[model samples]
Target: MAGQSKLSELFIKCKSENRAALIGYLPAGFPNQSDSIKIIKAMIEGGVDAVEIGFPYSDPVMDGPVIQEAAEVARNNGITMAKTLEIVKEISGTGVPTLLMTYWNPIEKYGPAKFAHDFSDSGMEGVITPDLPIEEAGVWLATAKENSIHSIFVVAPSTGDGRLKDVTSNCSGFIYAASSMGVTGTQTNVANTASILVERVRNVSGTPVAVGLGVSNRAQASEVAKFADGVIVGSAFVKAVLQNPSDPATAVRKVAEELALGVRER
Candidate 1:
């Protein structure tokens, strides 16, 4: 097969149908762990094509204000790596492809090899480590692959051509392309930049590219899907729940529905 299973095949299937996959991200224990699971289940019910379960870490330099706050809330609520895996197991019961987005620190602390085996057993479809560049991916990559866990890589707007090929060469699932130059939550009118990166990644990697990091609205998501296989809505979705003046679940469901509408429309 050209691309591995999990998200890669899922996006290919979606693309064949002339549709873009919707990948939603939410921290494991944001407002609360129980509430987080409920929101996840609701997201699937609301038509999310795939889900990224974020494992909250302390030094998330790439995240924006909203996700940083959500991580803090999760940490304050005592959401550890072990508990997060349990949550992943619970969510996988929904039968949707769910990946774990995390930093390398926790994996280092927990040991990448062991974490890979256990995480796959816990039902994670894949793992996305933005800070773990391809050069540094060794044991973790091998271990994840050995256990059938997809190991994803990220490519940014500033990534050069040669390095772009290196980044996506052995990537298991989809390649996450950062839309802007800055952190995860900042959105700009850089559709052309995103499109360029998407084309470059496709040219080299022949892998599915999902644009993330600043996509917060239906229009933005729709615009991005024009050239990308999928769209990742993160900070905006987290912001929706936090910005809810009244009901947070409603906020999540609303954002989820809007993105689903955006992806399905075109």
Candidate 2:
């Protein structure tokens, strides 16, 4: 059996503190490789509990405009699978648990076993493949198990009770609960359905649940934190970098700090 991952440890620590973990996301090589590394370090300095590095896919169906733009910038700057893994190595070295959020095509093209092993070697504690379903995740799950890494899965408000059980059962680190049934982005108000989805996931499994999508500010983070084990913010962070091209590191750090306060306040 695979041992407990850093991601699992983070959730436990957060639970003990009576607060939700703050997870921040950034695409590898966004703006540029060297600067991207600095930006990730800044996020850590700002109290982000965990990090999710995007793999910069050409067709990110689940990503919103902010994230898609970041991915495009990273791709145009020559970000590749190898480069992404290098970024993972640098950030994971900070002792903060790191995860890669990517589409299934990249993993399929890279070869599942090799991909899993390489990712594990890069110090990533888990992987979140949004497009891959539980029924089709047999090989990937097995390889992730062999690597002693967690196979994270997504559960949305639209997920039915039966399917929720199957999906959560296959997940190891945490179950990603999409707050709404839409592409990822920041919203003025988080959907009420997020809490409902979290409740359903709890009824089916004991895995920690993290709510993502539509969470951009501290208030939204605090609201979600009230019911979730973790709060994931992506587009908001990407937007911060985009808005402050002169010094994206500082920009993202500020956003991380604000969101961190939100989670802790909850």
Candidate 3:
């Protein structure tokens, strides 16, 4: 469990193949539960290294328009914490590593200990809560760690060396280095800023660093991989599915393949 649960080792495995990991993100129950499973399976078949299953939260402050809209639709479709857990089990059966992307409120609502135990039992590998700060991570970190679930931490471009080291030290999985100091979504030409941020984070932490937030294309992903071990693409894929939910599996496959190739080409 120790070696199997660490995200950095997973990233290194992907790196050894001369390919950056392609992490796909989708809101659980996006178009509906049926479609969500289809998309997850599509991503796995299309070569995605991992998947980030988003739990719908009414107010996802850090997510931008695309993800925010998808979350709203998921919540409207009656997607709840319990439903997400069930989805985790289904996805796990597909043999692709999965992480739950969520907020703190829902975990608290479900009781941290119970949530962690149940989630681990259901086959989730880890969790990413951008809103959970280093100081407050202690609130749920222990429960998560007890179940061998990695607690993913986020470090922003604005984070100084001291805070960066502190956050990375507490991180068991790969550290997410936000490409910018803003919400998740599309952005124009972030190469320069991304390079500096990646170097800063790499210098501070031995953990594998993943670059996320505002990455939308192959070109951008390739550029980011030059400085980091993994690339996390979310909004672009979610927006693609929302555009054609009836056949989201196809869209997921297409995007996943494209991104996978993009990273592998690097």
Candidate 4:
């Protein structure tokens, strides 16, 4: 198993502060590579505790329309795995713990070992593989351990207790607790079942739990933070940039600030 990574440290720090960490997500080359960097920096500046830079893939099974549209824009602008890594290096350089959110096919195409090495070299602390099942993650898990990068897995409310234990045991960083059964997007109400799912995970593993999906504003962040160790906001951040093409950085920064306050208030 890999030792404590920056991702783990962030959770520890958040716990010490009696608050949930604010984790924000955005595609690597959304809008454009140069502008994407600015948007991410704006997220950090606005008080995001950690960052998850998405590897824009054509087929993102877990992503909703908002994220899917952002990925399409990145792909149209020629955002390759190499370009994604460049963005990761820049964001990680800001000294805020950074992670990569990617699908399994890209890692398989890049060669699991090489991909892990390159990701760690880029200064990323972890990788979130939403579609990679624990049963099929042998090579990827081993490679992630070899490179000293945290392997994060996503668990949903629909996951069985037995499966939750299996998946949580393999997780090195925080466990991503999807707030609902469906794909990722903002929701008027974050499912009440999310707290139940978090409790179930706690019964099996001591890993920190971060809730994502349907959390868009400060109130939602505070609500999730009440039970989770971290609150993850993705679609809302992507939408901020998507809606404000002329000044995307400023738009995302404002959203980040609002969500940051949510985590702290909880």
Candidate 4 Cα outliers beyond 4 Å, as residue runs: 186-188
Compose the digit string of candidate 4's lDDT tens values, residues 1-266.
34566778888999999999999999989989999999999999999999999999989989899999999999999999999999999999999999999999999999888888888999998999999999999988888888988889999888999999999999988999999877889474774878999999999999899999999999989989999999999999999998999999999999999999999886
Residue pairs in steric clash, candidate 3? none
How do the residues 1-266 of candidate 1 rate in per-residue lDDT, one tens digit apiece? 32455566788788888878999999998778888898887777766788899989899998988899999998999999888988899988777888999999999999988898788887788889989998889878888877888888889988999898888886877889988798988868857789999988888876688888888888888888888889998887788778883677777887888888787666
Please, what are the lDDT tens digits per residue for candidate 3 over residues 1-266?
64575355668688788767878888898867877888888887877888889998998999999999989888888898888988999987777778999998999999999999999888888899989998988868888878889888888878888998898988767888888878999585666777798788778777777889988887888887777788899998887888875687888788888887777767
How many clashes in each candidate?
A: 0, 0, 0, 0
TM-score for each predicted model, relative to the true structure: 0.96, 0.98, 0.96, 0.98
Candidate 1 backbone collisions, by pair: none
Q: Rate the local accuracy (lDDT) of all candidates.
A: 0.84, 0.91, 0.83, 0.92
Task: Specify the poorest-scoring 10-residue window by lDDT in model 2.
Answer: 1-10
**Model 4 steric clash pairs:** none
Candidate 2: lDDT over CA atoms?
0.91
Flag the better candidate by TM-score, 3 or 4: 4
For candidate 4, give the lDDT: 0.92
Worst lDDT run of 10 residues, candidate 1, spans 1-10
Give candidate 1's root-mean-square deviation (CA, Å).
Answer: 1.6
> lDDT score, residue 226, model 1?
86
